[model samples]
Target: MKQLYYAALIYLVLGLAGGLGYREITKANGFTGDTQLAVVHTHLLVLGMLVFLVVLLLEKTFTLTDSRLFPWFFWVYNAGVVWTAAFLAINGTRTVAGEPTGAALAGMAGFGHILLTAGLVLFFVCLRSRLSTSDTAPTTTIGR
Candidate 1:
């Protein structure tokens, strides 16, 4: 749970930076169209920060980190976020600067998506395991 909390905080910083970076960089470049950079901040906020915060709550109720798959989910999901964000920054900057784009960055982004999907599957498996093993304690009941 502490890990999740920390991860969320870290991502919050990164997300803010991403949004600011996108705006300033675009303005500086005098670019006026949409680019992959636009979504980077939202992705970091939703996937990296918000998801981890939610999982921290889930961990309190379901003890999700107890599962063998939890660590895998953590690492893989983070890797995906980082990979995807890096690609967006790189490709987006190139596009903004009127540089030719390449397929390699797209390929890397696709792989990041794969990692994210795998991480989600693992999270669900851990969730299901917890669901089957025990009932939620009323004290920890969410949305009360």
Candidate 2:
């Protein structure tokens, strides 16, 4: 949980910094044609920061620490997001600068997507196990 919290904070910084950095790069370079770099910040926020934060909070509602899959999901998901963001930055800059993106970058990005899908499946599996257990304690019980 602490690790996840730290990861989320890191992503928050990365997302904000990435957004500002990409924006300044475009502005300074007079890039008005294609701005795929625009999504750099969004991807970090949504896939990295937001997802981790949600998982951390879910830990409070459910015993995520007990799961065999949560740790794997956490690491795999972060790796995929990082890989995807790196390529997004690279290809986005290339596109904005009117350079050709080679096949290697595209292949790497596709691999990242595949990893992201696998991580999501693990997350869902962890969530289903927690929900299916009747002995699981509710963080907020409403009924009297």
Candidate 3:
């Protein structure tokens, strides 16, 4: 839970800072030709900050840290979000600068999506186990 809180806080700061940085970069460069760089802020906010915060809340509700797969999910999801956001920022800057993009960046972004999918699947599996009706009511309080 603490790890999740820390991750959420870190991503929140990064998302806010990245949004401001990207806005300034676009303004300074007069980059209105492409919307690629514009996506960096959205991804940082949604995937980095929002997702982690939601997960932290879920952890509190579900006591998700008890699951063995949770640590894997946490790390993998964060890695995917970070990897995707980094490439988005890089590609967005390159596009704004009128630079040509290569295949490597695309490949990395695809890999990030793969990691995100795998992590999500694992998270669902862990959630399913916890949601079984056989579990004690005291431990699995839904509205508490």
Candidate 4:
């Protein structure tokens, strides 16, 4: 889980660098338009960094009874995020390049977002069930 968290953080940093590089190159080329850098930044921070960290924390804090779901949730959510980020980056680049709009690309981005949302919801549900079933016993200290 720590490794996954670090990997997601690395991707977030890379996304930042990519956005900044795009801006610099565009500015140097004297190109200006609505490239949606804000969207890219938000997506990177939320989906890439925030979501992955949350998953890691959840894994560490809870002992899931049904461990079978963990791998499914992890893979689906990560894949969804990666797909979304990749498509958004491509779309942003194409928009900046003044290329013809592709419906398939837009659809891919939308599908990825949907996948991510679904994965997160499923993960939360699983976690909630496990936590509720666990016994919460009060702790006592002998010294006290």
Using all chains and alpha carbons, the TM-scores for the candidates as numbered come to 0.91, 0.88, 0.86, 0.79
Off by over 4 Å in 3: 133-144
What are the lDDT scores of the predictions, listed in order? 0.90, 0.87, 0.78, 0.73
Best by lDDT: 1
lDDT of 4 by residue, 31-134 (tens): 68766443666677777787777767766767542566766677777778777877877887777767765899899999998889887877877787767655
Model 3 local distance difference test score: 0.78
Answer with 1 or 2, whichever has the higher lDDT.
1
Tens-place lDDT per residue, model 1, 26-143, is 9999999978999889989999999999999999988998888899989998998888888888889889999987898899888888889988998899899888766654446679
Candidate order by TM-score, decreasing, is 1, 2, 3, 4
Residue 126's lDDT in candidate 4: 77
Off by over 4 Å in 4: 64-66, 135-144
- List the candidate 2 regions with Cα displacement exceeding 4 Å: 134-144
Arranged by lDDT with the best first, the candidates are 1, 2, 3, 4
**Model 3 per-residue lDDT tens digits across residues 1-144:** 778777877887888877887888889888777655677667767877787788778777777777888888888888888888888788778877778878988888888888888888988887776665226665566897
Deviation (Å) of 10 in candidate 2:
0.6
